[model samples]
Target chain A: MTTASRATRNATSRPGGRSARVRDQVLEAVQAELADTGYDGLTIDGVAARSGVHRTTIYRRWKTVAGLLVDLLEAGVDDTWAPADTGSLEADLVALNREVREALSGDSSVTLAVIAASFRTPEAAEALTRFWDDRYERSAVVVERAITRGEVPGDTAAARVVMAATSPLYHQLVLRRSRMSRAEADQYARDSAAAAIAGLLRH
Target chain B: MTTASRATRNATSRPGGRSARVRDQVLEAVQAELADTGYDGLTIDGVAARSGVHRTTIYRRWKTVAGLLVDLLEAGVDDTWAPADTGSLEADLVALNREVREALSGDSSVTLAVIAASFRTPEAAEALTRFWDDRYERSAVVVERAITRGEVPGDTAAARVVMAATSPLYHQLVLRRSRMSRAEADQYARDSAAAAIAGLLRH
Candidate 1:
């Protein structure tokens, strides 16, 4: 999986060319297939047919279905959906909520498939765990900034702060299967921010 | 699925007799098979052999793999793991969190299978949705009691309180694949309770 991921990360050597276009098209096809069939049922041949990319090319590049999915998962997580650094914690959290709402609510099947795949195999689980751990660590900076500004206690748990802000949206989207409108996201942001400010997130 | 669930619900007709024992053995076999093969690869015949129950009996009763899985899901959800009414919002939430943590953390594979099956079919999705909605509604009573005690506003959303209190456990267990400890659950309960008390859960 690491080798394949390295290949994908470096595959952009031909960025801005026909190769990049083909890569984007194939990744799009992969997402569509994931939404339709999930990880268990996904196949390289199916992706080839859907993307009009040759099977030989997909095989040569990705090497396996899990490899292809790892790449897709990485891309999904690396799409630059960063939390805002607004001067105020409340506004920053609201911006972060909106970004997450848009990212996840767009295609829930992808996340579900990743979850399914994660439990099915150790490699997949490691990949998914890394994706989230990285995201959480990166996003915890917002809480750190809040702490620096004295909006929250110095001992506040940054990861917990971020998790408090975002878990409800994930809960609604994945477990509850409910819609997360901007108003709902706003409510969550406000509530979680209030909780953080009150020192509820401190260890 | 409904008829099978009805049968399982009333399977105690021959309490302490062959009928009850058969039901237990069959459900145990279903969970074992679900854990081993997952819903995609599970089969009625496989469950029959594992349980040593006649295939005809299983088919006559459960009718489909999804039906059997649904019954197992219902029984899992219907277990006597109600949220505690400990006369305080914080204590009740802590009790609820412990119950949920114990239930879900007992067998990760079973929940993963339900999630996998849910995304595979509309019926499974409906069953999963119903399971969570029922659990949420049932557990919201703790927050309602808090309102009555004047610990929180009357307009505080009970479901939201419950969701806020419990979503982190689910998020960690299912999505993040992180280890959930008793301390973590306690922290979540306290933080969510504080948020509710601060009127963050209104509406």
Candidate 2:
């Protein structure tokens, strides 16, 4: 399907009215603009024009450009929930890493753009915090399950496990100065998962 | 000591001519600007005016604001290295983490400002890569020594361990909305060091 069609489908899937639709359109426009022009070049007027929404409506929902961008990130980025009982902690963790890798690599432009803008805006920082916190919460459930199954120590801090498992992928994205290929992502996922499992078992 | 006295002393320590002093003054002015106005508000002309150095002299050493800023970061940030000879991996790791925290909390506005600017500049991104790699190399010595001493598994990747020890601070600086305080930095260092040691032992 075309990108616009996919966005339309996504918008329709959510329960909302005309205002919500306008918001979604604006967000979609913003994402597209980010991919095309990057964070430094994205403009509110351009988003208003592309979304076919009134500037007043955009302003009402998100007062600042940073605020609008943060809202878009919150709405568009998919949060990975905890893995189901895979009968083994290793299997569950691998599944979790795969999901994170897919999410990061699939929409990398959006992620990078948000990161670029985040340096300048408090709202963007808040969005990033929410994003990381959501991932941590979901991954924590898997770690907690491992502890319950006696695969890991009962007193393990699940959040640290999650951080250890996913930090390398983030490091690659922001600090490595290179795009993350699928193969590289897979390797990072496997290695980090193993390291986290090893950590948990030791405790 | 007064800032000028320190600068004069540094100038006398180096074997450079008047031009070098001009460059140093301009760079110092840029650092002061970063602390006062932040990365977004920094300007080349402002540095020249603040330092009473010619704009041409400033541009001669560093091509752009980003380049100048990156140089400032590289010059200011010391490699906080520690040897892993404590016999126990956990003890070694705690010492390493303490050093990292101390360096991060020190009066190093140039490094912090450059990190902020990296979110916007490709040049800054490249500089960040080199900076992090240098840091990793220093931390790697500790990890390698641990492996040789049988405190950690021989197969352990020093790069991963170093990254884990450092990632949380960067994560907080970039993604979290809250300002990282000394207490938080200390807690993170302790927790991360403990978790990494536990993981190493498991392997």
Top lDDT hit: 1
Worst 10 residues of 2 chain A by lDDT: A1-10
Q: What is the TM-score of each candidate against the true structure?
A: 0.83, 0.78
Query: After aligning candidate 2 to the native by TM-score, how far in Å is the CA of B78 from where it should be?
Result: 9.9
> Model 1: clashing residue pairs?
none
TM-score of chain A of 2: 0.76
* Candidate 2: tens digits of C-alpha lDDT, residues A1-203: 00111223455467688877777788888878877787778888888988888888878878878877777656634422335568766666556656555544544366667766877787786777776666566567877777778776777666656655566666666645546666555554454455555553233
- Which residue ranges in model 2 land beyond 4 Å of their true spot? A1-11, A76-87, A106-108, A179-203, B1-14, B49-52, B73-92, B102-108, B178-203
For chain B alone, what TM-score does every candidate structure achieve against the true structure?
0.79, 0.70
Quote the RMSD, in angstroms, for model 1. Answer: 4.8
Full-model lDDT for every candidate: 0.75, 0.61
Candidate 1 docking: what grade? medium
